[model samples]
Target: MSPNPAPRPSASDTPPRRRSVQCAGPHGLHRMSYLEWGDADNPDVLVCVHGLTRNGRDFDELARAMAPHYRVVCPDVVGRGLSSWLPVKTDYQLPTYVADMITLIARLDVDSVHWVGTSMGGLIGMLIASIPDNPIRRLVLNDVGPVVTAASLARIGQYVGMAPVFPHFEAAEAYIRAVSAPFGHLSDAQWRQLTESSVKAVDGGWAMRYDPGIGEPFRQTPLLEDVSLWPIYDAIGCPTLLVRGAESDLLTRETADEMGRRGPRARLVEVPGVGHAPTLMDAGQIAPVRDFLLAAGAAGGGR
Candidate 1:
């Protein structure tokens, strides 16, 4: 399915604010940069984690929309966006991400948090929230589940794990759009924002925000024919919401259906024109999220 052209934002538009926190990493210390919106003192903390190659900025629109209700924290996973790169590329696995999140949560000093994750981020959230004494009160898994498709995994492995340098931002944007077309319809302006957010100015050209070596571990992981994460999903005790792009290749329809039927009985919301993931950047996307968060909060009553 072809992506719809993303709406254009005016020149006067202001991007989201960013802040950094030093977190303990395998290599001693690392700075994790994140985009923060809403009241810092608001105890209602909502942590939004982005996809593999994507950054925290992906949640800019969603954060702004959710700020009125909760303090939205969107972190740039290590080795991605403005976050510090990992010294050991092998440390780019889920355990490292969970550890970083734990440090971030400790810094927040919040008793519990509401989580929203896309793709790889969703997997991280699932792993963490499934722990025996996890602090996540509610979770929203965006286009990701325990059972991932090999075809989608292969497609992601083809590009995400690689480092691509472009002579100009336009070229980089075009490349991202081409590869991410599976993400459904997005406006030209949205595509532009995505391209701008993902690339950094190098000596003469632009390079991806993450370390090129990340692909090393990603490539080495073997693909499973039939992935089942039932135990992990079953262990989650909090209210859960699952959002999937209707045309997503990564989160198969069958997996999404099974997710709803299984542990926690995740409520599923399918975005009509998206695939692989939903970027919660528009009203249509944000509504379900806001509704879910409110419902989760009401149901749990301050867990």
Candidate 2:
């Protein structure tokens, strides 16, 4: 399916707002950057978070599709994109991310929100939704679940801390496509958009925008090989949707099936011909999410 042009902004003359929130980290304080689309004052807010080594702009297509129905907010999780990097490598874990999200939600001043989280971001959403009195009105877990595969972790870690320099953006786009092929089919335009935000021109060359030291935590943690977050997943009480790429190596079919059988009894949707993750950048990818989120809105809230 072809991707839809982004909906005309509620006020077409204005563009998506770039906002920041001051958040505390183990080292001190940093500002997390976010792009807000749709009605800022609209009570209906949806937060879309990106995967490991990915920044928030990865959701541009997805957020654009949902903006008319929601105050779509996408955060460049600290240490990536325009957000500040953590000084302490160990601070790159989920706890800090969750805290930063809470700060962001508070800034939005909305009582509750819908969430679409991809990969590592999904884990963060699970943790947040598990908490008592949390505000995740509905949850969408994209290409990640309680259990992750060791092989997938190994594959990801291989390039997590990469610091390759490119003479031009096209060169960097090639590198990104090589590593991100696991994200499955994406148009040249989509991949190019991702590449534009993933790097920066520095010293007459380009380098990744995120802090390379973030990889230290990946190396330090033993959780990759033997991680368990079922207790957290099971505690989530909100309506949930779990989206998995049919060929995803990280979120196994077995795990995806089990997700449907238990804990939130999450509604499951699978996209064929994708692996590791599905970039909801096209109509085929974004339809289920739009339908799910709007259904939830119609049933109770998000107006």
Candidate lDDT scores, in order, read: 0.82, 0.84
Stretches off by above 4 angstroms in model 2 are 1-14, 222-224, 296-303
* All candidates: TM-score: 0.91, 0.93
**What is the Å distance of residue 194 in model 2 from its true position?**
1.4
lDDT of 1: 0.82
RMSD over all Cα atoms, model 2: 4.1
Tens-digit lDDT string for candidate 1 (256-298): 8888887888889999988878888789998998887776234
Q: List the candidate 1 regions with Cα displacement exceeding 4 Å.
A: 1-17, 296-303
Per-residue alpha-carbon lDDT of model 2 for 76-189, expressed as tens digits?
Answer: 998899999887888898999999999999999878888999999899899999998888878999999998888888778889987588888888999999998988888888
The candidate scoring highest on TM-score is 2
Query: Which window of 10 residues has the lowest lDDT sum in candidate 1?
Result: 1-10
